[model samples]
Target: MTKIFIIAGEASGDVLGYRLMTALRALRPGLEFSGIGGARMAEAGLVSLFPMQELALMGLAEILPRVLHLKARLRQTVQAIAAQKPDIVLTIDSPGFTLRVLKAVGANGPKRVHYVAPQVWAWRQERVKHFPGLWDELICLLPFEPDFFAPHGLHPVFAGHPVLESGADKGDAARFLARHRLGPEAVPVVLMPGSRVTETKRLLPVFRETLALLAPHVPNLAPVLAAAPGIADAVAAYTANWPHKPVIVRDVQERYDAFAAARAALTKSGTSTLELAMAGVPMAVTYQVNPVSAWFGRRLIKVPHVAMINLLAKRALVPELLQEQCHPEILAATLLHLLRDDEAAAAQRAGYAEALASLHAPEGTPSHAAAKAVLSVLG
Candidate 1:
């Protein structure tokens, strides 16, 4: 049996990792998988070395308190990889943790494939200098990434954006509405604060306030909070006192159903944007890192827009209300505009179509393409 150790640090990575596992298994069944992942990967039968949440952190200020703990996890991971001695190590995203694992395993160890290339091209372009020897191969999800890394002596395999195969556009809206006892008249709006606890805690209150401000204008506003994996109970507790308690969507299918039923979305800037766009749901992206992280980010971030949809469009297709601009009133106003204005919503949908067309792989589904890429690395 060929041993392939995999690691994924975030909810999004877990999903991507799970799909990759499924695809790889189809390509090579009886391949053994170990290493770290979350619920989805667990479903794919990976017994994680530690709780993946320990590495699900983001932002400088957010991660500072967990620095020592993260370092320990890093050491533990490297030691685990060394002991396991798998034929190949697939570290999915979480560059803070995965990249270190790749580097520590080194060129001398098992061949390393870092799935989901880090966004070094967006900010801190200088950091590209250090990426040369970290992995034997890099798997990139975006279309533009291979060109970005190629110039730097890194030949990344483009697996295309995984969101294309996510079944986001296939959600049954009638089933979703009937499942939730929501009427056709009810305006279902998806509230995706984020996948991380820090993001959920930070953004949910603002979402609540936005709902409060929006309730009067929108008739029978049926709110749905698309909770990320393992956060349903926490999301339940966090949203207990909201203006209107949202129907908390737990798993992938439910989240897609919610996406289908949703008229619009108030979401954090990330893969969720791509998912919403794929579902043809209009959205306003919002995010906040603590003041210190924001301060540093302002100086380093080279990109004008944070939403992946907008970034792919190479212009602001969706409204971005980040940091100081992520106020409840602003969120309510932006969402209201999307809901009430058909022309504006249609314009965004048109842009989404134009941008998303670029995300398809040169070959089969993204996971299949990625599986092919990983297998090629094995040879």
Candidate 2:
């Protein structure tokens, strides 16, 4: 039996890892999987070494205090994978934790594969040079990512964007709206703070404040908050005191339906932006970080825009309010512009159409593509 060790440190990565594992199982039924992941991966037969949350810390500043703990976890993961002697060690997103663990595993000359290539295209292009020595195969979700790695002597295969298959169920939308007591004429605004507690704490207040500001101008503004799997209680507590009650939906199917029906969205900057684009929802992105970390990021990052919509378009297709600019007034203004202006909304939708086309897989499913890359390296 062929054994594979897979590590995915957060919610999105967990989802992606599970899908890939499922695809690999289809291709090779006797494959064995073991490593660190969340509920989804566990359901897909991954025996996690530790709870995925231990390695799911966000932002440089948020992770600073936990560095020692994270280092210990990475060392433990490396040792576990090394002892298992899997045919291939596949590390998913969470570059901070995954890369450090990869370095340790690679030092011993282990066969390894890296999924979802880091945003070397955005900044730190130099890091591409190190992958050839660290990972035997690179499987990327974005089409352009492979070209970036090619120059560095690493041949990367483009796996389709995992979000392409995350289609929303129309029937679920009506049922969810009825269950939440949302009227048919109500224009719902979806608020997706983030999948982690730290991001929820940092972003929910600003999102709430933005809704408060937009309430009078856009009456019948029904806001629905999607509670990320692990942090439902945290999200509920954060919204408990809000002047306006927002319906919290937990099911992924219903959440996507909410995205499909939403008039507009105010989301944290990440894969959610890609999802919003996939749903053709006009949105404004906002993000905040600790003061020191923000200052450091400003100096080191070279990207012109933070939102994936803008990055993929090679221009500002969606407004990104980051750090100081992530104030409620600014977010409301940007969202209002998108919601109220028909022409602007149409233009943004066109950009979304283009982004969607760019993400389509050429030959096979992304998970299948990724599994093939892993197997090739293992052989």
- Candidate of highest lDDT: 1
lDDT of 1 at 201: 83
- Model 2 per-residue lDDT tens digits across residues 327-373: 98998888788879989888988898787678777768767777777
**Best by TM-score, which number?**
1
lDDT by residue (tens digit), candidate 1, 109-149 = 99889888899888998999999988878889998899999
Q: Estimate each model's TM-score.
A: 0.98, 0.95
Give me the runs in candidate 1 sitting further than 4 Å from their true place. Answer: none
Worst lDDT 10-window in candidate 2: 167-176
List residue ranges in candidate 2 displaced over 4 A: 107-109, 168-172
- Cα misplacement distance, residue 258 of candidate 1 (Å): 1.2
